[model samples]
Target: FLNKGFNVVDSSVATGKIEVSNAYKIADLTDAGAISVGKQLGAEVIVKGKALAKEGPRNTGSKVGSYIADITASALRVDNGAVLGSARGHGVSRNISEVTGGTEALEKAAREASGKIIDQIIAKWSGEVSGGGLIQLTVRGIGEYSDFVKFKDIIQGQIRGVQAIYQRSLEGGIAVLDVEMKGNAQQLSDEIARKNFGGIPVKVIGASANTVEVSLGGAVSAKTMSTPPSSPPAAQPSPPVPAAQETSSFFEADEYLVFSGDRDENGRVGKMVTRPTATNPEGEFLMYHDGQKVWSKFFKAVRSAAASELQLGSRIYFFEGNHKEGVYYSPKDKSEARLESWWRDPVTDNSLVNNRGIVTVGRYRVDVSNAFVEKK
Candidate 1:
């Protein structure tokens, strides 16, 4: 058996030379010893058999009968104390007077008994000991993005009795695998698709002669390993302003300052002339405009105009009315008009001025030609 490259264990041949080492264990036919030996040696089953040799009478021509050889063999399982199989054989010598040939007859009887016993045992255990073979696999043309170890583990877990021993690198990005097979290989290929590795699509690239060599090739799926979080909307650029509209010009007048005071510097210079000028409290000059004492109307119009222009910051001011009847000028437009109003030192309070007297008002306009101003 060893010369033919078959793994076989023989315990009776003590002087025989075999390449593989033999293991010897001392055990009796008792049930306890059989179970202990089975567990210790990691054997799935323990076989035990006995051979019995007997002498019987054979038919002769004249006398009743001469003595002949007989043998019986019985085999059983020691672990469970169950009778696994049994075989009995008998052999008779041609000459009854030949007592010296009894040894040869006994040996022949034993060999016949042993062969029958072995055949019975094998038939009983054939179902449990079949389909265990080695499977060699080769994987070729796998890209660097593929994780081979993880792929192997996935395949092994899905398939029954498939074990990846070791992977070796070959030329041109090829990998070889020594796998122990306990089942079919086609089932394993179907399982790989079901697992959906890395959420990417995959396909078998190539297969070797024994259907063991497998190659994978396909594009990665949209769902990658690392998923990104949802983000907020990005800021958009302001719309472009029409060039013709941007080139258009608009006139903007300064604030109108109106004041009422005594002309002769008298304690009671009643109802003097009133005038308006474009000026601030610090006497800074600006464009002047003449208008009625209607300060509220002018204030509303200028504010609305400035809002249409998209002005960010604008201001309006109220000053004392002039001594004139009902005329006003932009105080910020001229220096002499600002000094004339200051000399009266008139109380600029709105409540102090009567209906007949002109009141002062100041307002400013803004330019909205720029697109950036609308965005702000």
Candidate 2:
């Protein structure tokens, strides 16, 4: 959920700590137990979930068994023991193996439930903000006590709709503030991103529905980087871009390949296609020959590509382009691929376009000379 802008606690770390403490059974944990565990893990919210799976049907001739799974999840605010929201999902799968089918069904259900629960939480937070509620601000890079005091003053005096600020804790240049504001954390973050506090550079690093994380460019020499006090100019802040996180996408065996051609000297003959998988949301190049995947490599896109790029039809195709160094296709044979889309990078504020004829898996090059362009 980092892409959604919340600082998520690692699940493995919390699980390991809970396992060692002999805490309440995860499946049957109470609200009190959840709050205790959340406090121990320094988490503001705790998400609890359960899954149930059952075999539905069996086709003996085809050796395909059907399984159904149901998943339910809820988010709890640890401080108040309040239920933010809950969601449920169902999934069905058919597989030759019973265990595999059940597992797949459960995974699908979990993904659906997780997404809905996250959406609910964000909606709830937005409502709370509109009603004038509390928001948490994590400020870092404070050079001294004076710097933090000045920062707090700026928030209270300059920012609109700020009711009050309560200092939760401050240690090692990091301070957590409980802010009572009429506006949401995202709005506050965006406003802060555009300001320069007395020539102290500020950046909004992370922001969510209820929380914002900011860093000040202060440590060694703040005055050295400061401009004249009389000539202060406002700068348009670059929007934040969410970094890549780990995710997995399920693909069936009958997945289609987009473009293929004759084998090169390395015996790598196949169609090259792009897929935006969970692991590589940017995109990856997959090569397949005779309906079998030969190799796959990640592709650097101008921006995040759409998951629709992996459609199981002839929507993907090779286009004619001039052959260049580090590219696999040439115009002479008319076997090149180009992405004819453009997107603006929020962080860099730059227009990016992806038009490539390159196809390589590590040190090996794949031939695409005889490939023909086809689109559905």
Candidate 3:
């Protein structure tokens, strides 16, 4: 029966006497155990049987007795424990005295039992009662980038009842595509591996219920490190220097001086003084009462006062004179007319004044003796 491709699970006894050794092992069959084992083994049809034999009338002076054998077979669906069908076969042997022919009788009984089982199994399988299920196929591979979608369609077309869901991941510097099966996952997985669908190799990653996941590279890892860095370090700005406080006390009067001249020889007269002013043509002058210019001398005395304010070095400005509008003066013109013009206002027709100053000694102070003296 096994050679005939029929799975025969036997349990039979002949009239409480085992005609065949170890035949009782075949007799102890349970529907539950058979169904459980059959389902576990993926069997579509399960064959179970029972046999009975009794001695017939014995021939005169012969050591043989006529024997009648009855056999019953059943086919069941393992999936849902449904019985497909059942059949029984009965046969009588005329010569029952020969012990040598017992083997033949047993074989004949087994054959008859299996034939009945197979006939019922086939009849039910071909009938409307047989259940129909689907097998889905999944295919995946790696090659040309454009081939991913094409391969998926090809696999879906070649395998019936198969729906392909494609996914991609980068692994080992290669892009991998996974084709998942949506029906009869295991069957389709086996089919894909066997048929080599999509003209490329396929592998089964996992399967459950109606879905099977297939990956390229045949068991290759799907983990990828292809994502780029999310963020980068921000650039930093240079530190700033604390600005000096702009207070009058921070500046001294003497530091504002540019140049000093000698006093005249007469005690009543002094030498001409040239000093910087806060005006266009920046170095201007003031006439002193002693016939000595004291603007430069007065500025020299206060030169050290504004030393901290001379960031770009001392600038010389000529003082014109003190007025109600404030001190008027001019800037010392440089070779660059653009710089000179920047210090002068075109609209106001007035010179842009800076911080340097020129002062008249008699206007602020009364000291006139030895105020101007010529160098010996």
List, residue by residue over 1-376, the lDDT tens digit for candidate 3.
5776765544332223323234324444545556655655556666666655666677689866677665555565664444554444566675645543444455577677678656655654443223323222233334433343444555656765543332324334244333333335466666656765445555676654334556654334433333432432121112222233321221222122223333211111112223343562233222111111123333222111222322222221222111122332232221111011111101111111222333222222111110111111
Q: After superposition, how far is residue 190 of candidate 2 from its true place, in Å?
A: 21
Candidate 1: residue 132 lDDT (0-100): 35
Which candidate number would show the highest lDDT if scored against the true structure?
2
Show where candidate 1 strays beyond 4 Å: 1-28, 31-47, 58-70, 74-84, 96-105, 124-126, 129-376
Give the alpha carbon lDDT tens digit for every residue of 211-329 in model 2: 78888666522323222224211221222332433111211222222222222111212233344457754322322211122334322221112322322221222211222332324
Pitting candidate 2 against candidate 3, the one with the higher TM-score is: 2
Relative to the true structure, candidate 3 has a C-alpha RMSD (angstroms) of 53.2
Tens-digit lDDT track of model 1 for 315-372: 2221111221223222332332322221112222232123423232211111121111
Q: Which stretches of candidate 3 lie above 4 Å from their native place?
A: 2-28, 39-42, 96-102, 128-376
Candidate 2 positional error at 164, Å: 15
Query: Could you tally the backbone clashes for each prediction?
Result: 29, 3, 42
Please tell me which model should have the higher lDDT, number 2 or number 3.
Answer: 2
